[model samples]
Target: MSVEFSVFLIAVAFIGLVVSIIILLRKAMATLDEANKALAEAREAVRDLGSEAGSVLGHANDIAAQVKDKIRAIDAIVNSAQDVGQILHTVTDTARKAVAVLNHTPQAAQPEYVPTNKITIRKTSIDALAKETDRI
Candidate 1:
């Protein structure tokens, strides 16, 4: 081939290669833009999910604190009840001792009643009077 014709053909091939590269670069840029938009949407969704998780954790912490407070209050109530029970036991013991002293007998040696002849006669008369009153 002549030098000028060969040079022209090489120039044409170079231009075509440049055009093809430009078209490929443009398509790559469009694909990159789509990927960037998807990435941005994913980041926003993650942010929303993080915010929702934070709110849920805050509510759970509040409930845990309330449960702890309630448990402490119940513990205080149980301790107070035990103290009252101890005081009641002391009072009961004191009352029992006082009754034992008033009775003036050993705890195991309580006296039994023995009716005399006079007491028996009075009881029989009272019973007869109650029967007559019931009839009336």
Candidate 2:
């Protein structure tokens, strides 16, 4: 072959190789841009999930506060129950003492008769008595 023809062929091969390399580089750049966009989207999704998790944690804290309040209320109820038990014990003791006194006391065989004073008066006398009582 002629030297000029060989040189021309080498120059064409080099140009083709450069063009291929440029095409490969552009494809790689496009893929990298797509990957960057996907990463940004993933980061945004994680941020949203974090906000949702914070909201859930706040709700859980509210529930825990409510449970604590209920426990306090239950404690108050138990204290009231203890007070009621003490009152019942006092009442039971008094009733037992009264029963013992009644059982030990002797009953009279004959019932005593008491006379009530009777006043017989005219209507005028009743009116005077009513006036005197009213004054008193």
Candidate 3:
């Protein structure tokens, strides 16, 4: 009777240990499932951040290109201004030379003296005198 009772007690203990092990495994599986869900969420957030970073970089590149174009335009304007300044200086120099030449040119001199004379007339045949006067 003692031997039968000991065997029954060992069988009961073995069943309890198996049940405990199954419960612990179920809890562990639940924890692993929660961790997997959190990992998936983190990965999604990282992907979104990467996409936003790419957009920002693209905008920066566009701005850089626009700035480069503006700088080139400014350089061209400056060169044109320099050319205009040189042309203006040349025109000014030419105008100054023309004014100097005009200032130094000679003028025609007026005659210094003039004489006054009187003439005498004699009576003659009327028609002949009229003709001679008309000829003079």
Identify the candidate with maximal TM-score: 2
Worst 10 residues of 3 by lDDT: 119-128
* Comparison by TM-score, 2 against 3, better one: 2
Q: What is the lDDT of residue 60 in candidate 1?
A: 100
lDDT by residue for model 2 (1-136), tens? 6999999999999999999999999999999999999999999999999999999999999999999999999999999999999877766565555444434545423423535575333464445444544543
Report the CA-based lDDT of candidate 3 relative to the real structure.
0.73
Candidate 1 on 47-123: residue-level lDDT in tens?
A: 99999999999999999999999999999999999999987776656555544543464532765464654322235
TM-score for candidate 1, residues paired by index:
0.65
Q: Which stretches in model 1 have alpha-carbon errors above 4 Å?
A: 99-136
Off by over 4 Å in 2: 106-136
List the candidate numbers ranked by lDDT, top first: 1, 2, 3
lDDT of each: 0.76, 0.76, 0.73
Could you estimate the TM-score for every candidate? 0.65, 0.69, 0.58
Ranked by lDDT, the better of candidates 2 and 3 is: 2
